[model samples]
Target chain A: MDEFSFIDSIKPDSYRQSSLIKGIDDDAAVFRQNTQDIVTAVDTMVDGIHFSRETMEPYSIGYRALAANLSDLAAMGAEPAFFMVSIVIPSDWAEQELQEVYRGMASLGDGYRMDMIGGDTVSGKEFAISITVFGYVERNKARYRTAALPGDILFVTGTLGDSRAGLECINKKIDNEYLIQRHCQPSPRITFAEQLSSFNRVALNDVSDGIASEGSEIAEASCVDLHIAYDSIPYHSSIAELFPNQYQEWILSGGEDFELLGTISEREWPEVQQKAEELNLSVTKIGYVSEARESKGLVYLTMDGRTERLEKSGYTHLQEGRD
Target chain B: MDEFSFIDSIKPDSYRQSSLIKGIDDDAAVFRQNTQDIVTAVDTMVDGIHFSRETMEPYSIGYRALAANLSDLAAMGAEPAFFMVSIVIPSDWAEQELQEVYRGMASLGDGYRMDMIGGDTVSGKEFAISITVFGYVERNKARYRTAALPGDILFVTGTLGDSRAGLECINKKIDNEYLIQRHCQPSPRITFAEQLSSFNRVALNDVSDGIASEGSEIAEASCVDLHIAYDSIPYHSSIAELFPNQYQEWILSGGEDFELLGTISEREWPEVQQKAEELNLSVTKIGYVSEARESKGLVYLTMDGRTERLEKSGYTHLQEGRD
Candidate 1:
C-alpha cells in the first residue's frame, strides 16, 4: 500500500476525545485548548539497535516503543492524551507485520485512552519507529528533575534490573518467561505518578537509563547530592538467584526498567507510602537527597560501609563492544 | 560524546516563548496552556531514501526537515510555536556535522519564532531526522481539507515544480544556482497562511505531493470536483526553460514544492488577492470548485481544450523502479 493508504488503515476507528479537532488525513492535527498544561516527549527505536527481529516481534517492538514515551510522560506526572507515530518501513516488512505493530501500540494506548492523531510514514532501508506522545498535567504541577530538595527522601517504584535480566535471558536462550515479559512489556507508572501529583513538590525521573544515571540527573539538575544505600535496592528474586555475581551490575547499570525514581519531602513520605500501598504498587525508599559538598552535583552509593561516587554506567546500545 | 552530551550541546541558547516551562534535560517539555488551539504534525527523513548525503549536506537536511513540518503547520493556518526533533545518528557522523544540522533547523525556525523543546537521539545504522512541530491557531479558525465549497476559487501560493526541477538539476549534475537553492530551501507559506486565517472559511493543503495530488485530496475530502485550467498553473520561468518537455510532469506529479494549494470563496477572492499583493506574494487562481456529478469527487485538468482525469501520480520516494 502507499503511504496515504497506510495512514488511513492505521487511523483509530474513533477518536476518544472531543478536544481532538482533526486526526488523520490532515496536514496537521488540531486540539482545542484546555486549562491544563501540555506535556510532550518523543522516542525513536531502530532495528538492530533498540531491538532485533529475533529478540522482539513486531508487536513487542511497537508496544515497547510507545511504552518508552509513556514512561517519560509518567515521569512528568501527566495524563496520557494523544500521540503521533512516524515509522520508516523497510522493504522486507509485510503489510500484516506493520498492522501488528500498530495493534501493539493501540493495545497499550487503549488503557490510557490515548488516541493516535497524525504522523508520517516513509520507506527506508531499515525499520524505525519514532513516537511523540502528548499528555496533560495540572498547571505548574508537572514533576521535574530540578525539584529535588535537600533532605528529601528518594524512592523508586517496583523492582529494578528485571528488564536487563530479561534481556540476558533472551541472549543466553534461557527459559524465564517472567523476565522475558518484563523486557517486552513494561508498564508505565501513570497511575502511581498521577497520585504523586497531589503533593505540592516532587522531583521525578524515569529509570529508562537505570537508577544510577537517573539519580545523577536529578542531583545535577537539582544541584543537590544523592546518597543511596545500595543494599536497599530492590530486585526480583529470580534475578538474584539466576545471576548472583552479575546482578549488582544489572541493578546499577542496566537500563530500560521504565520505573519511576523520584524524591519527595521527608514529611510527606508517610502519606505517599500509604497511597502506594493502597494502589498495591511497590514504593521503595532506596536513598535520600542531601546538601552538596565539594562535588556539588554527584551521586553516592553506600555498599558494605564503603561509599563512592556512583558513575553513569547505564546501558548504551551499540556502544558496549563497538567502542 | 554520548547521546546525552550531544543533546546538551544542541539545546537552544534561549527559548522564545514564556509559555515553554521546561525544555531540554527533562523527561518531557511542559507548555502552559493558552486560549488558542494547538496544531501538530510530524515528518521523518531517512538517509539515502529522502535525500542522499551526496546531494544534501547535513545543514540542508536539517533545514529541509524542519521546513517540511513547518509547511504542514502553515497549511493548517497556524502560527509556529515549538518543535521537537528525534534523530538517529550513524557512527560516521561527527559531532560537528550533527551540530550543523541543528544550526540549519534553528536558522529557519528563528524566522517564525519556533523553539526546539525536547526530542530523542539514538544510535542507528542509518541517519534519520524526525521532527514534530506544534503551532497555535485562533479557536475554530484552523483550516481543513473539507471546508471547500462548490463555488470556491482554487488557488496556490508562489510557484510550483521548482523544487522538483531543482532535484532533477542536482541528479543531472547541472549548474543552476536558483534551481539548486529552490531544492535546498523552499520557504513555507506561513505568512500568507496566517493572513488567510483572517477569512471566514477556506480549504487548505500544502503542495508537498504536487498540485494534482493535493488538489485531489481537497476534492475528495470536500466531496466536490476541482477543474483546473492547465494554462494557469504557476511555475518558475527557469523550470519551463530548462526542462521544456518535462515541465508539465514537474508541475503535475513532482513533489516537495512546499507551496500552498487552497480554495477560498469566490466572494473573498478579490480581498485575498489584495492582501497577497500587499505581502508581494504570488497567489494564482488556477481553477474553481464545482459540484461533483457521477464521479462524486474527482479532479480534472483541461489542456488544449480537452479535459481529462488528473490521476494521483505524485512522486513516491524509493518506489520509482524497485517495484
Candidate 2:
C-alpha cells in the first residue's frame, strides 16, 4: 500500500471535530479555543521498565499511557482537552493487536475529549507510548506549586494508599482481583481537582511518585516545609487492622496512586471542604505548611499530641542499581 | 531537583526563549503567529532498520533523525517552529552518548528555533528516535499532495538518486567521501521547502521514497495521473557516467533523496523556475499530470515519445513471503 493510503487506514478522527483545525494532510493539527488558561504536560510509558512483559496487557498499556498524561493535566487544576500520542511498536505485532490497542486508547481518550490529532508509528524492538496533553484553566485561578505559603492547610484527595495496599494484597497470597485492578488502573481526581482551583490554592502536585516524594517536590518548588498530621490521613476501612502502618508506607511511598497533593489557605478551608463534598472526594486538612520547623520533613502528630519528623518513603533510582 | 531546575537542564533559558513560547513549565508553549497557513509533519528513524551500529555515529544518527522530520515541513512549505522527540535507547548506551545524541539533536533543533518541548525516553534493546515538527504557511496557500490538477507540470528540487548512490558507495569499494557524506548526512532542504510554500501554488512532498514513487503519490492523492519525461529526470552528474544502467536504477528507486517533488500549473511554471534559480537549486520539469490514456497508471515518456507505465521504486514493508 502507498504511504497516504496506509496512513488513511489508521484513521485518527474520532474526536477531531471538537477542536482540531486540521486533521491530516496538513503540517500540524490546529486546535483552537477562546480565552486562555492553558495547561499542558507530557508523559511516556515504556514496556519492560514501566510495565513488565509478563504482567502488561497491550490494551491496558495503551489506556494507561493516555491516562497517566491526562492525569498530569488533572493534577494542575485543569480540564483536559486535546492530546497527541506517539507510539513505537514491534513490526511483528499483529494488525489485530494494533487495532485493539487503539480501541483501548480511544476508550479513555474519547471520554476526555482528547482528539487524537496526530501520531507516529514505526518499527522498534520494544513498544513505547508518549503522550502530550493540553488543557485550559481560568487565567487568574490556576493552582500553582509556587502559591503554597506558610500556614496553608494541607489536604489530599481520596483514600490514602489503597492502590499500594492493593499491590501488597495481591502479593500476599490474597486471591483478589481488586488489588491488581488498583495497580493497573489509574483514575486521577480531575473533576475534584479542578473545583479546588479557585480556593486560593498555594501549591499542587500529582502523587505519581507517592505523596511523600511529590510533597517534597512541592515543598522544594514553593520553598515551604510541610508538617502533616499523619494520624489524620484518611484510609479505607477494609484494611483497618494494619491500616495505620500500611497507609503510612503506601500513601507515603507508593507510586501510581495518582492522587493529588496540594495545599490551601486556612481561610479557604470551608470552601474547599464544601467543594470536595460536591465531587464525592474525601478532603482532609491533615496539617499545615510552615515557614521553618524543627524538622524540615513530614511531621506526624501522634494521637497523644506528640510530633515527629516523617521518614523519606519513595522509590529511588539507585534502589537496585541504576534504573 | 526543582521542577524548573530539571527543565532548565534540558533546555537553557537562553535557548528556550528563542522560540515564540518557552516550553519549560508552561501550561502550553504558546505559538503566536499571524498567518493561518500551517504545515506539520512527523517521521521516525530506528536504529537497526534505518541505521546500524557499525555504520552510524549515534550523534549523526540523532542529527539525521531530526533532519528527516524537518524535511517534511519543508515539503509543505512550512517554517519549523518547534518539535517533540521520543527516544528509547539501549541499556548499554553510556550517559555521554546520550548527551552527545542530545547535543546533535539540539544543534540541529536549536538552529530552527524548534524547542525540544518534551520527549519520552526509556531503556530498550535498540536506539530509536521519533520527531514531530510544526511549521506554518498561509492557510489557502499551504502546499498539499492533492493540489495537482489535470495538465499541471511536475518539478523536483536538487539531484535525485544521490542518497541511493551514497548508500551503494558505503557498501562497496567506491572510495568517494562525497557519496558517504550525502548518504549519511543528507541535508533536509528546510529553507528551500519553506520557500516553496510561499509560492503556494501546487501539490508537493519531499522525495523520501524516490521521486517516481512520491510523484505517483501526489498524482494518486489528487486523483489525476501523471506522464513523465524520463530524459528530463535529473541525475547527480558525478555518478551519471560511472554506471549508466545502475544510475537509472538508483534515480528511479533510490529512497531518502530528501529533495522536494511537487506539481505546478503551466501558468505558475515561470515563478517556479525563477524561485529555483533564486534558491540555487536544480528545478527540473520532469512530468505532467494527466488523465491516463491507455492503462490507469502514471506513464513515463522516453526521449523518442514512446510511453510506458511508471514503476514503483523503493523500500516496501511487505516481506518476501507476504507478497
On DockQ, the leading prediction is: 1
Candidate 2, residues A1-323, lDDT tens digits: the string is: 23344457667746544545566544345544445544556566777766753565667777777777766777667777766666677766666666666677778877766666666676678777777666766665656566778888888877767676766664564555655566666676778877776665546677777766777766756777777765777767665554555555675677777777788888888888898898777878777888855434343333335454444445332122211
For residue B178, model 2's alpha carbon misses the true position, in angstroms, by 3.0
Per-prediction share of native contacts kept? 0.92, 0.28
lDDT scores of the candidates, listed in order: 0.89, 0.67
lDDT of 1 by residue, A175-203 (tens): 99999988988889999999987899999
Q: Could you tell me how far off, in angstroms, the CA of residue A234 lies in candidate 2 after the best superposition?
A: 4.4
Residue pairs with clashing backbones, model 2: A27-B39, A27-B40, A28-B40, A37-A137, A40-B27, A147-A202, A148-A202, B37-B137, B37-B138, B37-B139
TM-score of chain A of each: 0.95, 0.84
User: What interface RMSD do all candidates show, one decimal each?
Assistant: 0.8, 3.6
The TM-score of predicted model 1 comes to 0.96
